[model samples]
Target: MASAAITLAAEAPKLSSANTGFMLIASALVLIMTPGLAFFYGGMVRVKSTLNMLMMSFISMGIVTILWVLYGFSLAFGTNNSLIGWDSDWFGLRKIGLTELWPGYTIPIFVFMIFQMMFAIITPALISGALADRVKFSAWALFVALWLTVVYVPIAHWVWGADGWAFKLGVIDFAGGTAVHINAGAGALGVILVIGKRVGFKKDPMRPHSLPLVMLGAGLLWFGWFGFNAGSWLGNDDGVGALMFVNTQVATAAAMLAWLAYEKIRHGAFTTLGAASGAVAGLVAITPSGGAVSPIGAIAVGAIAGVACAAAVGLKYKFGFDDSLDVVGVHMVGGIIGSLLIGFFATGKGQSTATGVFYGDHSFTQLWKQCAGVGAVLAYSLIASAVLAFLLDKTIGMRVTEDEEISGIDQAEHAETAYDFSGAGGGVVGTAVSALAGAESKKVDA
Candidate 1:
């Protein structure tokens, strides 16, 4: 009877239907963030370059998806070595069965693959904000392909892969503080250095063309982030998932308020742009710390990140580097804040048995590990991205011609415009009605 029972227990499947469903839903939610990013970046640029901005993000979704299926996933997640993963047998997911569990998880291997793919898609898109309105579409696309192969896949392996050095070194990145945000932020700075600034950067009034659109994008990004932060647990039954979900909300709200407070104190008035940027800063800061920090700790992380990123954005102007949309400020700086603070705020009971300096551990061991992860990823991404951008600039040209940039990237590159101000609706009466109604003109130089 004992032998029969043991055999039956061994025969039971490891897969859990409920967890699989949850992961499927989470993957879809995360997929929506790329389009949300398109809108977020599109509205932040001038109207004349809106389509170009949108395309820069949208194209990444397509490019990264294909790369993930072909070799990106295998290289990042497969088991080959400590620094990088070899294709082995999982190239193109070949021979991997759908029912096969992802190592120790309840979800199917395919489900895990798709979830990680969405992350790969958005990381490079984040860099488009820095090079907005100035890059050639083809060159940008090529850079995405090369950068993913060289920079992203290797960094992902180092941080998340089981045999990777960082993972073995006790570094704690619940989601992607170092792997995604810091990597992309550093890459953005590198690319902008090689590509140079926009034609009339400091001399021009480059305000956002549509604050409403930016708000809409920010809302979608916030909503999708619930899936991003919570789903990293790879299971729905874990109580930590709930904690992470709440932490995400608390931190984002706190960060938005802190940003406004800082802006009010420094600039004399709260701005819509500050609110949207603050929300994003909070999201980025809490991502890696959410599963480890308490709600109160999340507030501290968010507020610190908000103020730091807000101040960091201005440094570009002082230093003469034009990070058009402050990707370096919010993502890189926010990622560092979240990663390092975990050493001080981590509860030592959840996620991992690691406590921060503020949590009474006093050792500062975990904090040093976080610093190592952040510094390694930041340096690798910066150097690799700079090389890629320089090679592209020399061979195929990274920037648009001066005439094309000044005239408008949308028409010069894509031959399309985001808005039409031809007044084909009703001519003079429509114009007069719009004016009487206080409707802003589409032709206005936003």
Candidate 2:
């Protein structure tokens, strides 16, 4: 009887295997988003620095992927106190093999580590859009590496880790409204302040080189976002997972329609770029609230995000901050809208229990909490990012020379062009030397 029981137990399907498989697939979906971001930002930049813009995101994947495996995951998810994780014993994922600490499931710790690593990779890359076309690639790389160490890992630990201070404080970030979007948006502002605006900020026409690429990137982002939002469930549950899935779709669609409608009324045309941008804004808005809100709430969130982002994007002209790709407008404003609105919309007892000043909860407790979270994230990210950018600027220099700015970083720094239709014989190395020679000759002529 004992032998027969042991055989049956060995043959039975393991729950951990299923969880691990789902996590790995989800992680893969999320990883695709970095390249998706490449196309998204690439299309928005001038044709001259298209590849350089894309390279910023692509290289983040390479750099952060390695760092996450080495010590990032440990600092983020390791069993340590709240402020920051130590790399003493669990330096290279050594202790992860011994136990599965995440509750309610039995997946390998490595799977969870890899999944979170993807988030760490893309968050900083999102800021690259704001500083596009001017910053030196090497300096940008150094800045992100330091920023992740100083800013991202600690905040992630605070919000998501077991012993995190925010978790203890009951700051409910379902999937990184504060950690990812708010953090990236605030950081973008800091980096832009330090790096300065693009060469022709107000004057350059700076139209998207390819609307199709924008749409494609948007599609990929939308597809990957399902996993991003839904997989936060960390298990196959019908209630929260289903809610997240529906909310993600509703909010995105609503936002897209609202953006197009606004554009038609204001500009007399509904651009494909508007559609894509609206979808992204909606997705960002829904990300923090998808698990907590209902379908109707999602629709409202999406519509508001669409119109709000459209209006907010124009703030660059008014407030005069050159967020080159609308990072502050779409991400910062959209994040605030979603985070605050969720206070009113998260209903219960058929009466909106946690309602904002609107449906009771009149003390505005939830709204205050939401605002506090947003403010904290913004302040921390802004200060930390500014310090890191300053350090990099002082040590390695941030922006390229004005000559390099006009000539394009693809040829000057990377020595390669995004498109080589002219049958240029030289690769990136040759282009760099030629560009440098041109700069020197111009200096001599002057």
Candidate 3:
């Protein structure tokens, strides 16, 4: 009877329908973030470049999805060679058994693949904010392909793969402060250096065209982020997923308040843009630490990141690099701050056991490990992204013509505009009566 029972237990399916259902919902939530990003970036640009900004993000969704299916999943999560991964079975997401589970986890291999696919989709979309209003749509798309192949995939393996160096070294990235945010931020810096700034960058106002849209995007991103952060655990068998969810909310709230405070003191008002950007800054910072830190630590992480990112955004003007939308300031800096804080704030409680400077035996072991992972990803992504951008710039040309820059990127590149201006001599709404009069005087317009 004992032998028969052992055999039956061994043969029972490892798949967890509960976990699978959780991941599917999580994947759908993460997918919405790209459109949220589109609205966020879309609202930041002038009306002239609105569609171009949005398409830059939307194109990444299209491009990365194809690449992930073809070779991205295999190369990123397959058998690790320390620096990268490969497995022909996962090539084109093929040949795995219908019920095959992902090694140690109860979820099916396909569920894991799709969840990670959402990550690949948004990482490139994040970089588009840095290049807004200037880049050719085709060049940006091609660069997304190249950058994914070279930079994002490898870093993801390094930070998350079972046998990768960072993972083996005990680097504790609960989600993706290193793999996603830092990688995207450094990559943005590289491309901007190669492509240069938007025309009349510092001279032009370039304020976000629609704060309401930015707020909507921020709301969507915040909503989607629960899946992005909590779902990283891949299952709710343990209670870590709940902890991560709470931390995400805590840190994000602290960050929003901290940012508003900073701007109120420095810029003399609490700006909506500051609130939105701050919340995201908190999200980016806590992403790596949420699974490990207590909620109090989460507040510290969020507040620090919010204030730091707010200050860092102004550094572009002081240093004279056009990050268009402060990708480097918020993402890069926020990721770094969150990662390094792990060295000090880690309590050795949850998903990761490595305690930080403030906890454990007070040793810096985990801190050093975090530093190694952060530096490696940041340096590699920056250098490789710059090379890709340079090659694309030299070959197909990255920026639209100067005429396009002044005329409007939407019409120049996409041949479409965000709003209609065909009121025939109305110009820009002289008055309610004048607008009606002009419409009546002119032929009907589309």
Best by TM-score: 1
Question: Which 10 residues in a row give candidate 3 its minimum summed lDDT?
Answer: 437-446
Clashing residue pairs for model 1: 343-356
Give lDDT tens digits, candidate 1, residues 49-125. Answer: 99999999999999999989999999999988989997656788887897988987888889999999999999999
User: Where does model 3 exceed 4 Å of error?
Assistant: 1-13, 423-446
**TM-score (all chains, Cα) for each model:** 0.95, 0.88, 0.94
- Candidate models: Cα lDDT each: 0.91, 0.82, 0.90
RMSD of 3: 3.8
Q: Name the regions of candidate 2 deviating beyond 4 angstroms.
A: 1-14, 86-89, 98-101, 348-360, 423-446
Model 3 accuracy (lDDT, Cα): 0.90
Write the candidate numbers in order of decreasing lDDT. Answer: 1, 3, 2
Which residue pairs collide, candidate 3?
Answer: 343-357
Ten contiguous residues minimizing lDDT sum, candidate 1: 437-446
Model 2 Cα lDDT, one tens digit per residue, 233-269: 7755346766888899999999999999999999999
The positional error of residue 394 in candidate 1, measured at the CA in angstroms, is 0.4
